[model samples]
Target: MATVILVRHGRTAANVQGVLAGRTAGVGLDAVGREQARRTAERLSVVPLSGVVSSPLERCRQTSRILVARQEHAPGTQVDAALTECDYGTWQGRSLGDLAAEPLWSVVQTQPSAAVFPGGESLRAMQARAVAAVRRHDAAFEAQHGPGAVWAAVSHGDVIKSVLADALGMHLDLFQRLGVGPASISVVRYGPHRPDVIATNTEFGDLAWLGALGPVADAPVGGGAGHGAPRADEPAARKLAP
Candidate 1:
């Protein structure tokens, strides 16, 4: 069996503001977000991680960096686009309240499978992309590190839940039932036959008694120094398109 640790990125301004950031370029972790990531890193220090993979999104990338930097593992941690948040499509940048005020938003919440985002992706599309990414990551880890290799993937809340739902063999419509909080950790095991979930919605500091390290110093929270657009060479995971 191979252990996969799924981590949701720290909180972001968009998250706190109730805006759908999707694939927006500038959205990142705020102060509280940074602390969340650091705490996550401190907690996972006890796991014998062989590799760390992250979404190219600033939020997940930042969290992955903090975790890996604290680990004794060697360099070359991978950043892939496969681990990205759901593309909110036309809903990107719109506040939840504003969207809720619109009639179409009701359809999205009530009938997501059939409701299409005006000029954007549907929930079905988002689930497909997210599930594919998780499968791909699992295959890659199995091929490279063999069984029993513990790997960590830092990604978005929605994305992580979607993946968990897939692993659980649940329907896409039940995605809402899986809660993935910022900087929270979920563990899954992929064996020769099937995938099994070990835990969910776990906080970093809560595991301090497990002997995991504490948060690092001066790590940027909420958001980090802004960067240019996500690298073009990276595979496209779901994104909030323009």
Candidate 2:
């Protein structure tokens, strides 16, 4: 059971403009977006990634390239359409403030399972395909590289959130409760019993600990010792936000 790190693509021009650029062509990462990706890449550089899969969108491709470049031995970026952004259809290229006025917007926020973009796909369909693609790739990586292997999936915010919701066994309607920021990392390891949500929407942390982790059948009953043992002088562990 390899661990999959879900990485949302860096911010884009559309993001700054509050526009939905769903499935739109030629929308690349903005300057701030590039910097965000580079910072994330620097954080992940300490760990060796066996595979790096990304959405076909330009912004994601750019972010993936940065991530692979920083890795010591990251396999080249592989594109997967199933990980692409949800098609916003008539809502594409529209500003968020504007889209909020649409009748379907309420359903999208409250009950995504029944929300379908006009002339595009439904939120339920997006989650199904995205989850399937991630699981498929996880199984393949584990079989080829062994269970200790780690991989990455660079995708859109909603796509990643949907996958996270499914991993957490939450219904699609509650998916909106999850927040996936640009260049953030969320980890999920598929185990025999169930998927473990290791981290979610993390912007900063020491992920080097992951390199030493191996597959486990079940989570520790008491949250297990935090990663590795604490240092002798380290004060009693206190919950810290990352």
Candidate 3:
């Protein structure tokens, strides 16, 4: 199967304001969010993408456009409803601090599988549809562009977390353990045997090695000389910009 890059949309006013934007219309990326997307684009410009799919929200569409703009091949972009934000229903536009006081908040924090927004979708249902959508697109890209093809999916935080949890073989209830910050990138490749999680919640790093990735085989013994040794003056891993 093809490799899929899961990109969470950059920050928005709702994010800065600590409010749940949910599927509310017209919620687009703010200034910092646009800059974050641009930085993400710079990181991804080294690799060629087969396509870019985004949630049908302004934030994700804007991020997708920025990403495609920096792509070496300028992959086409499209919208996928399945990749949209979780339907927070009554929770939409509510302050996070206020929602934290609701009884359901504890359930959402402790066991998301059983958490369902009032008049909205269940967390389990969200994971199911998102996993299905990602796998479907992975298969389509693999068939159309071959196994080495790469693609991007620009979506919401919770949506991407659920997809990552599924890819990691973690249960829905444990998905909250993962943290996906604004504009963070996660990489996954579906194989015949299992899905390989190449990276998760990455904000800074050189991704040019992705262009040279081989077939999705079993993990190399002893980690197999990862991405090559760093240069003498370089740190073993990149430090997040302050």
Q: Which digits, one per residue and each the tens of the lDDT, describe model 1 over residues 1-242? A: 55678899999998888888988897778999999888888787766677888889888888888888777665357887767766666778889888888887766655656666777777777778877766677677767776656788888877788788888888767777779999999977665566766578888434322222221123236654323333333357722344
* Candidate 1 overall lDDT versus native: 0.74
lDDT of 2 at 232: 33
lDDT of 2 at 49: 93
TM-score of 2: 0.93
Q: On lDDT, who's better, 1 or 2?
A: 2
Which of 1 and 2 is the better model by TM-score? 2
Measured with C-alpha atoms, the lDDT of residue 240 in candidate 3 is: 30
After the best TM-score superposition of candidate 3, give how far the Cα of residue 95 lies from its true spot, in angstroms.
0.3
Q: Give model 1's TM-score versus the native structure.
A: 0.79
| Candidate 3 ranges with C-alpha deviation above 4 Å | 228-242
Q: For candidate 2, what is the lDDT?
A: 0.91
Pairs with steric clashes in candidate 3:
none
Error of 3 at 160 (Å): 0.7
Model 2 lDDT tens row, 76-175 = 5689999999988899999999999999999999989999999899999999999999999999999998999889999999999999999999999999
| Regions of candidate 2 where Cα sits further than 4 Å from its true position | 230-242
Q: Which structure among the candidates has the greatest lDDT? A: 2
